[model samples]
Target: MTTRTPDAEPLLTPAEVATMFRVDPKTVTRWAKAGKLTSIRTLGGHRRYREAEVRALLKGVPSIGGDM
Candidate 1:
């Protein structure tokens, strides 16, 4: 089996990000829209987030660009 490196950044789905922050998935979408969080869009138009960014926000640490 292929192994993932511990330092590898994992992508999180909107639902996962929402669950981590204890907010609704729609709220996560709103955050993306408001530029509070950075998002990656799937070809299908679903939003994905970086776990690192999410965790930083959770700790009340703003992103380097101040998007949070």
Candidate 2:
């Protein structure tokens, strides 16, 4: 089991976020592009979203970027 620092939050894959929002993974990607959600790029170039932000969005909270 790997340990993470307090500031190191777990990231969510686009597919994971999609499942929570009942949307397609592609839609999640689009949302990132549109700034509806904030995404972090891995060294491999894949996008990862902050889990807390995604959950907040699911709760009908405004996104940090306020684009949603």
Candidate 3:
């Protein structure tokens, strides 16, 4: 099946991702560092995750780039 990519995906904070994964916020940061999750940096140096990617992980689906 072909999947369509959204032009503008919603970004999520570490805490928000943590809640979705039922993990600690620090664990979320570690996942970013280890490349388990992809993170985007803000101008203020905060990390943001793509909501679609995170949801895909929760559902055990591979992301677009197939990192997982």
Candidate 4:
């Protein structure tokens, strides 16, 4: 018999997602509520984002090549 451990998935907290997009945490929450981004709630009611989804959004965005 072979035993295997499933790989853990990467999940990003609202704070981390905010930092990635340079937005406020509340903005992330709003996006979640607006269905702009997919999010899962923790047992304690905190929102978490999937890295893959974030990456997809980032890819669609055009680079400005400078600080906003």
C-alpha RMSD values across all candidates: 3.2, 2.1, 7.3, 7.4
Candidate order by TM-score, decreasing, is 2, 3, 1, 4
User: Compared with the true structure, what per-residue lDDT tens digits does model 3 show for residues 1-68?
Assistant: 53548876788999999999898999999988888899999878999999988998999997644553
In angstroms, the error of model 2 at 30 is: 0.2
User: Worst lDDT window (10 residues) for model 4?
Assistant: 59-68
- Locate the minimum summed-lDDT window of 10 residues in model 2: 59-68
lDDT of each: 0.87, 0.91, 0.87, 0.77
Kindly list the per-residue Cα lDDT of model 1 for residues 1-54, writing each as its tens digit.
547799867989999998999999999999888888999986789898999889
| Candidate with more favorable, higher lDDT: 1 or 4 | 1
Q: Report the C-alpha lDDT of model 4 over 1-64, residue by residue, as the tens digit.
A: 5343687557899899899989999998988877788898877888888897777676775322
Tell me the TM-score of each prediction against the true structure.
0.79, 0.85, 0.80, 0.75
Best by lDDT: 2
Q: lDDT (0-100) at residue 22 of candidate 4?
A: 92
Q: Any residue pairs clashing in model 4, and if so which?
A: none
lDDT of 3 at 21: 86
lDDT of 1: 0.87
